[model samples]
Target: MASKQASVASFVESAPPGELSNVVADIKALAGNDASLLQSLEPAFRKYNEEQYATVKLPGSSEAVIVSEHNSMGDNRYFDTASQTSFQVEHSSQTASAVQQHPLESSNADLIRSLQKSFSKAAAEHFPSSVVGIYPTSSDSDIAILLVANKYSPQNFWNGRWRSTYTLSPSSGGLKGAIKVDVHYYEDGNVRMSTSKDVDVSNASGADAVVREIAKAENKFQEELNRAFVQLSEGSFKGLRRQLPVTRQRVEWEKIGGYRLGQDIGGGRSK
Candidate 1:
């Protein structure tokens, strides 16, 4: 059974021991500001990425001066690869050896789908002047990430137990700006970054409205434009969580099954 799971799982080579220090540093940074976004599940999430043996850090959501979104300069088309899709119930496992692999599990798949739905709905709920997206969904091992591309796209991670927040590499569309993002693993851990900007040039659904709003609200609060980003930021996100305090509440299956729970081809984190 372990062999079968390994055959189906996606695997990546671990970074040399030399890179371990950097990875640990990044995860700690993420834990500092984005703990609430993770909290209960970071431990399990780290376990799933056993190959990496580190919590994947999410990058900052945006650069300073989040200008009015010009018409989406990104492409609108995307393809779903069976191997590339996230949250398969089959994808969870603890790697006995760093080389061990596993398939996508159902719980993980659901998490991806949920986050994707969140991004789609944001277009309307956060409409007119808001931009949203999801990307860099890693389908390796039992670990996966579907980042919500808002002013600050919070990267959502799934082991079996699902958690979301920002992280450095194994990340998709990163936050824009000079602000750096990092995190520490409650379990399996990793850290990454890029010198280039993680521009979301693929999703074009809400481009028109986002563009219009950016044009309309050009010189307003840099804070206002990145409300979702700021709201989901390390400090502000705490306040937002206080209002919702995501406790054990039953979600009407039908609600999530219907339009109330929608997923865009672009990206929505679900599970």
Candidate 2:
């Protein structure tokens, strides 16, 4: 039991983002419906969710310690911080099979594949190291595409990621789509923002045309999102925080403690 638990921890610690579900599924298979064991793993998952990876490692796998940023592109990146060795992790055959059989691929496999190819090409060109995945939705005609871009700059004390999901489906106009964009920018501190918008792809007449239109719509959507992010970062956020006190500065309570001292009347302070 101890060995099994340690193996579970090892997998969780070394597993990269976009591949954790597969890890969990494999662990569950070994545990064989052990509810308590699954429940006990919650803390490990929570720590990973909180982006705590300073001590992440995979024992007996590599002599060098692995340093990974949560959701960062490329697995096993910067495996050794001292020498700065960038190690790329190879997926096991079992893991590869799990990825190929993603639950989302069960429905509308062809459409999902089409969108995956289109988005993957764009991602490779425009957003290097990003991962693109397409999934089928409950609705037969609706499909969802998820694109993740992550990076970390330790020298600058910042780590950030962009997660965008687009849902495309048939509509009266032509092809209807909606996009949800989530950004987390952590520089000295974390600042998160999310936004969503609905878009229309017109003039989608045939099957091939529909694919082309969807791709075009996604490009346009990304452009608009880019502008909006810039505005928020350069204009709105700065304006809102310009007057705020610096986070690192200490407050001198002794100096201003008596400035607004409440008046005592009849042994009680006035409201």
TM-score of each: 0.19, 0.43
lDDT of 2 by residue, 1-271 (tens): 6677667877775554334566778877988879887766765654453332222323323222222242223432322222223333322211111111113324556555556566667767766556554544545566545555656554564444555554555343255655555444556676555566676666554345555665566678788877987998899988876453444554456765554444421234657
Steric clash pairs (candidate 2):
none
Task: State the lDDT of candidate 1 residue by residue for 1-271, as single tens digits.
Answer: 3452232222212322223344445545655675443334333333333322222111221311111111111221122222232121111221111111223344345444444455445434533323232332343212222222222122432111111222212123222222112222222454332121222222222324323332233223233435645655756657655543233454455665453233422136554
List runs of model 2 lying over 4 Å from the truth: 1-112, 138-141, 169-174, 202-211, 225-271
TM-score (C-alpha) between model 1 and the true structure: 0.19
